[model samples]
Target chain A: MKVLNEMSVNFESRSVNEAFARTAAAAFAAQLDPTVAELNEIRTAVSEAVTNCVVHAYRDTIGIISMNIRIAEGNILIVKIRDRGCGIEDIPRAMEPLFTTSPEDERAGLGFAVMQSFTDKLTVRSKPGKGTTVTLEKRLSPRLSDV
Target chain B: MLLKPKTMFDGKVLTVYLSGDIDHHSARRIREYTDALIGELKPVRLLLNYSAVSFMDSSGIGLIMGRYRMMKLYGGSVSVVSIPPALRKMMELSGLGCLDVLEGGNEENESA
Candidate 1:
């Protein structure tokens, strides 16, 4: 298959990787003529999803989180974030808002919810212990609009 | 990511100004500091001046919700002021409007 326009990156620490993902996504979306708000929605949504992989999936362990940024159908932006860490056991239960298995931590279980809130679409595929992949899809607008 | 808390009126109205980006990593600390300050200062009111905040994600929402919860218990109110229109939309969708997310400055309560 022929590869389209895309960006791939990796980081050792979770602290800066999410920021880098958003920055990289913004740079790409900006070139596509998306408004700042739309870009932010895409960026923040991607960041939240990726951060989930970092903080929850792997728990800040040493792993490579991969991001694939590609434009789809002229106006849609798609991002796939995957991590080879401890995967999710129950997909449906985990997707629920405020559903965190870890109560010892202060997680609000808003990571996936926030991603879903900002993005046009989101899909999570995971196993019990192998790894997890979170895909975020957004339809970009020409300009950033505030309602 | 620097946190600047501006104390006004003998520390009656404590407005904590957050700059830079708010995300998963920073949300934890922000929540901790905010809760500690709220307990210690015990202000009459609180406001999050996000004027300098360049970016925020879902973690930001959690922090705001946490503060809102804390404020309710103390009989005080927490307001978000000077939000950029883009960020404002996020707040609006998150039910901050129904929760009464303030949209103006402290001018309304200056004389209070």
Candidate 2:
């Protein structure tokens, strides 16, 4: 098959990245007759992840955020967002469902857990002085045969 | 309008820039727009621009990874850029960086 598809964005924390992610994912789901339940779950996961970044990632300063999405077929989809500001040195501690980097921010730290549950495949990468990217992949259920 | 797709394209690639929160309310929208772009524009490559994006959870990841696989199927590649620092570390700890992710639009090469 012909390959190579991509996109980019330059934005700051105030841009409402979570809203964008939801709209985009919902748009992608409409292509197939996604179940109402599935759609709801997906959108929630997106919001949770975005809120984490906005609430805890950027802090008080306005910073840049990037989100990328791909649909391989009618059955599977992928979405990833990355930013370079303050890297998370301890992922395990952070991924702990109840762990919050900033308790002062009232961050539940459940974002990662929720995202993991929603998507069939979830991956996160980062460097101390670099950035972090959250990648999620899912296989649509009740397949209709064409994607 | 439930979801309106806005795109940025280079002759060899196409990038869809999304904003706001990506949650149960909008995952499907992103999916449909992507399918249309791939079907109609038929660019040699496609990418999702998540820089301006502020929030996202697993549904967000689902959207990104799904697209990555899509581009891979066509032989093209998918990429993520400008992820915030704290969020970037989260992805790394989760091992989600196995794919393609770029820092600050550095135009460098990275993968999920």
Candidate 3:
């Protein structure tokens, strides 16, 4: 994939950063001239991934959350959200719908599911004590007029 | 994190107008605000107006589910209205359609 544009951002693991991350990524993705729905889909997927970092990864203690966005050939948008916090011990169980480690927190455990549904491809890699990285990619099909 | 949930009471129906995105941060405040109202007023029907909600992730699902459970304890029902299509899809995919009444437009309850 030939990268046309790319940018990376690092922010604190605060809940407020959730919106910031999503908006920043969306603005960067705007270069591809995606439609409103496509832009929203990208934003929503980024929101879920970033929220997971703020809520589950850091878990009260402040940490660093980084996000990288890259626009590749064919208007393919790639997003990577990474955090150096307590990693997931059970990846399979964590990805299961309605399976939340912090059920008491009222989490529906639908983060992964939402990401999967919004993006074309989703990948999660984590080390128990190291951190977790979520990679999401979506090919934004240009509007009929643009094509 | 702009979670300014405005509540209007009309007899048995309590309508809350939720604005901004519903993420982990704002969800806590929203939960607190609505839960306090539900605890005090105990309305028979709780209506959540999401017309102004621009973005909502899975945390929105948690908020809805939590409110649903809370309302259920008091034998009340929860309904979401004016949900944007983007959010409607999220709610639908999360199985929230089965948990609460989802309607179009922002019509005030005539029955109150």
Candidate 4:
């Protein structure tokens, strides 16, 4: 699949950045002319991925979070959020619904579950003492106004 | 919009009306404020009004679930009111419907 356009942004691993990441992803996907519902789903998925970086990845320290968004094959919106923080030990268990490592923060352990449910495709890669990367893809339908 | 949670206590029930967006950052603040109030007021019922909430992600699930657990421990119950369809769907996806009552189907009298 040939890529149409791509953009990358880096932000600090801060809890507040969760909203910024979501808005940035939504704004980038806006050019695709996605529907309101589609846009919302994309934002939510982005929020979950970024929040995971701030909460679980760099639990006690601050780090850098990189997000790359791309449009592929004219209709597929791909987003990759990467963090240089503590990597996941078990990917399968982390993806399970309500399986959270930080219960004191009231984390429902639904971050990965929500991302998987909202996006068309969700992938995660990580290494201990390194970091974690999450890639999400969604096929967008053009908005009527842009058509 | 700046994140803020509006809290009100109607003698028996403490109504928390949340506006703007609910994410990890704001959820923590909301949890702290609501937990303090719930602990002090000790209301028999807790009503969470999310009608004004514009955007919410999975962080909301933790917020609601934490409050539910808090109320349950106090021998009280929690009810969610005026949840928009999209947020309601997200909550349902997290299996919250089976735990707490989703208000709005019946008439709600805030003054009651």
True contacts kept of each: 0.32, 0.24, 0.86, 0.76
* lDDT by candidate, in order shown: 0.75, 0.64, 0.87, 0.88
Per-residue accuracy of model 4 over B1-112 as CA lDDT, tens digit each: 3645778887889999888899999998899889999999999999988877889998888999999999999999999887877686587788887784676542456422
Q: Candidate 3's residue-wise lDDT over B1-112, tens digit each?
A: 4535778998898999888888887899999989999999989999888888888888888998899898999999999888877786788888877764777654665223
Candidate 2 lDDT over residue span B38-111, tens digit each: 86766777767665565555546656656766777777877676564434534453344656444354344422
TM-score of 3: 0.94
**Two-way lDDT contest, 1 vs 2, winner:** 1
Question: Could you arrange the candidates by TM-score from highest to lowest?
Answer: 4, 3, 1, 2
Among residues 3 or more apart in sequence or in different chains, the pairs in candidate 1 whose N, CA or C atoms overlap within 3 Å are A35-A144
TM-score pick, better of 1 and 3: 3
Give the winner by TM-score: 1 or 4.
Answer: 4
Off by over 4 Å in 4: A143-147, B1-4, B104-112
| Stronger candidate by TM-score (1 vs 2) | 1
Tell me the lDDT of model 4 at A125: 99
Query: Could you give candidate 4's per-residue lDDT for residues A17-104 as a string of tens digits?
Result: 8889999999999888888888889999999999999998898999999999999985899999999898999999999998998899
- lDDT, residue B69, candidate 2: 64
Give, for candidate 3 chain B, the lowest lDDT window spanning 10 residues: B103-112
- What are the per-residue Cα lDDT tens digits for candidate 1 across A37-100? 7877887887777777777778847787888888765467778888888999898899887777
